[model samples]
Target: MITPIYRVQCDGPGKEWLSLPEGHVTGADVTADNLIAAPTAKRACNWPGEKEAKRAAVGAGWRHAPDSDFKTWFCPACQSAGTRP
Candidate 1:
């Protein structure tokens, strides 16, 4: 069975942090179309489970924004730069 992959999005301007690839499509092969369609952003904490992902994210200077409707994770650069909303 395929499990969900969790990735923490970084609200930073750093190219390194903003260029991380998002999770792969489940139950699908990596094709050219998919590769081109895959969305990428400033993200980290690529893990299989949410809890571990969040833990690692936090450990890596990511913070969970409680006010956002969706789960938003800000990277260290964003935090340091005051770019987080």
Candidate 2:
């Protein structure tokens, strides 16, 4: 199955950056090489303390149709908007 990946920061006692896919943990003492597959619902907490994350998930590209709560679409132009600025 395809899953969203996350870049994690490890600080405090140690420092490192890790790539934690749906099944990985990126945190202290764990380098990229130390990654392991986490449980299926690993990303449950990814949005808890993050504002940008919640924004990206809900505000990125979505629409409300007649029968749907909201539909989502990707804006390629928006991705490039940062370079122009």
Candidate 3:
């Protein structure tokens, strides 16, 4: 299993805590599409997670790809890319 990246934060009572414990890795994949009429027109451009992920990616400097194959969750910039790795 992959070890999750840790996000440290100061607790309400001034204690440091690991917001993300571990083993929270994300995964993504794309599907095959074909359209002889137009190449660009067949592309999947509408990324559903764009709004929220972009904000987080801007603050974090870098972002990971979508967390699932279904476009359910993703970091900001990754969502902007709108392509699975």
Candidate 4:
């Protein structure tokens, strides 16, 4: 499981600058420190609003970035295009 608070490599990449590998999140990562097995140094998307958005993205087989300038989560296809200027 992985959560993004800033730019990161997600999926194939185009600067998705995003995770949770399905079973991993529900398995080994279930009780691994925080809810998502993300890097402790990195700020996770723990904010309420961002959390909701992230949930949606995960359900859609994509990743979420609350810091995105567009203010919307992206599916893999859109994630490649939603770059920060």
lDDT of each: 0.52, 0.31, 0.29, 0.41
Model 3 segments more than 4 A misplaced: 1-48, 63-85
lDDT of 2 by residue, 39-76 (tens): 33343234333343334433433112234332322222
lDDT tens readout by residue for model 1, 1-85: 9778775556456523312335654554433222211135433324678776566666555665679644776766667777777
Clashing pairs in 4: 7-17, 8-17
- With a 3 Å backbone cut-off (N, CA, C), the pairs that clash in candidate 2 are 23-37, 23-38
Query: How many residue pairs of model 2 clash at the backbone?
Result: 2
**Which pairs clash inside model 1?**
18-42
Better of 1 and 3 by TM-score: 1
> 83 in model 4: Cα distance from truth in Å?
3.7
Off-target runs (Cα >4 Å) in candidate 2 are 1-39, 49-51, 58-85
Question: Which has the higher TM-score value, candidate number 3 or candidate number 4?
Answer: 4
- Name the lDDT value of residue 6 in candidate 3: 22
lDDT of candidate 4? 0.41
Tens-digit per-residue lDDT, 1-85, candidate 3: 7533322222122222212212323333311121011112222122335553333323433333345332332333333455324
Better of 1 and 2 by lDDT: 1
Ranking by TM-score: 1, 4, 2, 3
